[model samples]
Target chain A: MIAAPDSPGLVGPVVLSMKMAHRTHGEGATAVHALRGVDLEVRLGELVAVMGPSGSGKSTLLNLAGGLDTPTQGTVTLAGAELSAMDPRARARVRRRSVGYVFQDFNLIPALTAAENVSLPRELDGVGTRPAREEALVAMAEIGIEDLADRFPDELSGGQQQRIAIARALVGPRRMVLADEPTGALDSAAGEDVMRVLRARVDRGAGGLLVTHEPRFAAWADRTVFLRDGMVVDTTGGASGPESLLAGGGRHRGDR
Target chain B: MSIRHGIIALLAEQDMHGYQLKVEFERRTGGTWPVNIGQIYTTVQRLVRDGLVLPAPGERSDDRADVERFTLTDAGRAQATVWWSTPVERGAPARDELAIKLALAVTAPGVDVRDVVQAQRTESMRALHDFTRLKAAQPQTDDLGADLAWSLVLDHLVFDAEAEVRWLDHVEARVARASLHPRPSPRPTDDPAAGGAGGGRARRRSGAPPPGGRRR
Candidate 1:
């Protein structure tokens, strides 16, 4: 039962917050409810894994939380700032400055080296080239891949490439990371490596949301939320330990 | 089961006494399967009777002597070599209590299969966590053989637990589907998107291709 510490620097319990969020697509006869009144609060030093069958609104929840998409009904707050209230440009700025994203595929640029791939985000955020490069090197070192800094993504193995992608996600002062099946492309050993990196990152006071189909990968998270039919049907709270599964019966059928 | 061949294999490496064999076996296997001294002596006596092992030259003939070392015979060497190359037999499925329990629960009256599955899942997950913690506590050693052997043991346990969890999920899903349709029939829809009302909604939301098509 590892709980997030109550730090004075933070405003409240949650870091990237969502409250009664709902997202509906299209109009009238074709309206599809992607997410229905979801309330999630990921605190600092927490990695929450979203687990569900295909098309269960897991990605929609992530998109809303990261400000890539807005909720139709409720609000999302990231780092104490209300994302729904912010304009598009302001939201984009917040996304760049505070949020990090890791896609299923290793989205590293083929032309850029590992260091350059990691530093590109920082440079885009108006960081000087030297400082960005330094930060990228530091991040690469953190993941034990500093030696691969100058190597292109093609030269690295799948595990190495994923590590570089993680380094990219953690390059700046981003407080929240959203990973969509980051281990999808990796083997079990490689997948565990990526999970270890992500877990270490979250343990260092960054909140993360990992979307994974594999229960083994989800086991690494602090908690797991099971989504079905655009709603959270079950939640394994605090720690994704075996005891949590036994604490509640099958499908609590309520919102958290 | 493997203790027989394991002892033979260690003897093939060097002549060792009973206590030394026990210590070496535990060291190589990361102490996961501790060999009792009585078991070692019994196994050694059996091997001796089978002519796979012989007392080393200059060693006393007394059975209780600690300094008396045993060396592998030609037959033992050949057997150990075969053990190295041959795979473990898996034709006869092992009798597992959990599997038996689940099978009984499914057929037993007044028994909730879901509850049984949930309980087993929790126990398996707890075992997985304990194994993970034990693996983490192991100090990294320069002896690659021992390190690899220990890691393989840990991996076997982890994979087994993961498979158990997956099996439980499958069982729960099957039970749920059966309850939904009293008379079970083949699933109607092959298209995952058109499988059910919820599936249709999910497909409409993310028109992007499903998580398939990538190399598993």
Candidate 2:
């Protein structure tokens, strides 16, 4: 007997069902095919990095995966549920319940404190305010910034704000995290910290799709997918080691 | 890698036996490169034969003996000074297998250059991660000279790996561009001067701007 589609042991990809999907903007001669016949799948506990030059449909793919945008053709399935098949209200519920997004700009509300920012999603999902706040604090602590829970976004540094944003994304039971250049605005050291946090979260069982141009950042992912002209050009199968490009073994030859 | 000079530099501090020298060398370099005992003995023997080093008095002559201490002579000290002052020669490029592989991959029939680059990149990244992790584990102390030396060596490895990854990216982009717009074959009878001038005009006609332009 087969396990039910939504059963915990079903163990299919967290995000799937983009077959020959296309996204177009505008109309007639001015139409821009932002994404063309793109197909991808991100499994649970895996972090897939999407790398490409600008306007190569990296963001479009992320948007589609996160259910923020619908595909022109084909389907998108999140957590084994077909997104396009759901009504607007049901789709919105699925997105809110299953998806989390980390943006480059650390899209946090200025008015809400760090805890409030992180807890808002849980509260919106009908969780009690106290429990949401407690969950938010736990998330903040997990990212190593529990002390900043009461501080507003303005009080935090760019790295701190990004961490808070990550905490917000991870606060609830969201299992699919979509990061769009999450480290674009930060310095290298802070960027590394963010990557580490993201990697740890993904390792804890969430699936992720990271859109980045930096190979160093992409190295943090389990696999890197290369996109060009709105299509998958190549994939490194999570084996793109930083030293593979350099000829020579790690050993340095030394004569006595 | 220049163990001869490295031994001389170590002797400049104090006289040491072959075993001690080997230990010192490995210690300073954080054991990234281990020198063979035989090799060390040979290097020391050559140094003594050249009069750059003199065997310390009261040491055994037996080749297998560990009691043979050596010290740098005045000339050897001068040579060490010169070695420190002179810049390393960069005239001869080292044989880089990655470069050769990529060159061949681009021209060889049915060979996927991208796959080669990607495979190498994966190895490079793993090496880089190992190096970085090693560097992080090293204790940072102001008073330890060996720590400083090892850190420098690790930094070299890190930088080299970083440069390799960047070059791979460059190769990938260049190959992609070249495939998109194949370059015209050179005319055998064309004048070098005329071709040079015509090439500029041809670039403009092809809608490819100069380097650092918006087209890129």
Candidate 3:
């Protein structure tokens, strides 16, 4: 029942902020207001979940927070850098160097081997082929996938491919990881394993933002932030455990 | 997630029977995920079919035919590694049935909040009772995990049920303290969202439970 208090002066060390106003697409009456006065921050090294019903702007919020899209009005500041003001090239660089993305589809290159997939990110950054491959092997080993490096995506099972996708995201240097429905493709058992890997990443001083529809998946996060209709409704206090998150959701006031 | 991964994770650590794997899976999950006896046997069959797990010959004979031990293959170990490394997206928790149900109960008139609460209480109690009986019937020689896991599952179920029951009681108390017996009103004819034509439903279905008892 510990709720995060709303205070402007009080800030977490890693404060990810979205301040004021609106975000819209089309002109006039047909405009899509994706965000309306979203003022929220996530602390450093914290794993947070952004949950809401369909079309509630949860994904839009994530896109704005991660610098994937721009807000028509307001600012999104990550680590004190105002992403909204950054140029396209700078924004792409920031996203590539600062943020890691994990998509639900695994998104692995079908033609590439597991090791090659993990190494591609670094190679794109001008890192040497041998060094990148070495680093990829290490990252794969960290996630318990060193032995499957040579196998192609199609050669591997769904779980294996997904694991490679995760390894790929975590391979290069990045401060924060953002995953969109990482476990949606897997069954319950496979999904649980994927969660454990994410949890381990958090334990290693990495911060992550996950957008999921699964309570079981959200239970692993340090905090669960509820959103409704383009506004953050509630946030379970930053507590790293499963029971509180699940039980707290059940006990939600529902009035808000 | 694949039960194959579960089987591999278990057998990779050590040899175990179907029942043993079920106990370990529940233990790892803090008993939040329940696996039935039938599911355990069926998963084992699938694993054997996939060549991920195979029988440990002469591990048990006579009377223990149903207790066949299983071990993972080299390929299974490789599969386990890949599974452990997979990346997952982190997202918000979705559509909470309990929250929605409570919201409806509080806002809707003529809704029997008591019936819902009572039904939940009865179901939870039966589960708790069944868990207790199973625990008592299990052999002393069974692994500690089987005993500990079932206990944790029962604890969560009981505690959750109590929290819900307490909430229901609080609602009733609030209503009684205020002595708020809402005056009955005439039923509306039109569907709230219907634009025109014959409206929504073909039949008017009452929100009432059938006779006899609660159904799962």
Q: Which candidate number would show the highest DockQ if scored against the true structure?
A: 2
Candidate 1 residue lDDT tens string, B1-216: 448899999999999998999999988975556778889989898999999999888887676667789999999999999999999766666666777788667656679887787666655555554444444345434466878787777667667666777777677666665566554232334685665556633423222344333212
Backbone clash count, each prediction separately: 0, 15, 14
Per-residue lDDT of A52 in model 3: 58
Where does model 3 exceed 4 Å of error?
Answer: A1-15, A237-256, B1-216
TM-score of each candidate's B chain against the true B chain: 0.78, 0.78, 0.42
Q: Residues A1-256, candidate 2: write the lDDT tens digits.
A: 1111111112335555576778888889999998888888887767778877777899899888888888877788988888867887888988998888899999999999999999999999999999999999988887688999899999889889999988888787888889989999998768867877787667666788999877667766766787877988776644333343223554442211
The estimated TM-scores of all candidates read 0.78, 0.72, 0.55
What is the alpha-carbon RMSD of candidate 3 to the true structure?
A: 16.2
Instruction: Please give, for residues A1-256, the per-residue lDDT of candidate 3 as tens digits.
Output: 2222221122236736678835787989898887777777665556777765666687888788778898899998766678899997888777776666788889988888999999999898889999999989987887788999999998987777888877787786765678899898998657756876775665455567889866446655666666656776556534223233323334333222
Candidate 2 lDDT, tens digit per residue, B121-161?
76665555455444434554556587788777766777677
Score candidate 2 by lDDT: 0.76
Report per-candidate DockQ.
0.09, 0.18, 0.03
After superposition, which runs of candidate 2 have C-alpha atoms over 4 Å from their true positions? A1-17, A26-31, A151-157, A239-256, B4-17, B20-31, B44-64, B67-162, B171-183, B187-210, B213-216
Candidate 1, which segments miss by more than 4 Å at Cα?
A1-14, A19-33, A36-39, A72-75, A230-256, B61-64, B100-119, B136-143, B173-181, B184-216
lDDT of 1 by residue, A32-92 (tens): 9999999898988788888776678998998998999999999999988899999999999
Docking class of 2: incorrect
Best-matching candidate per TM-score: 1
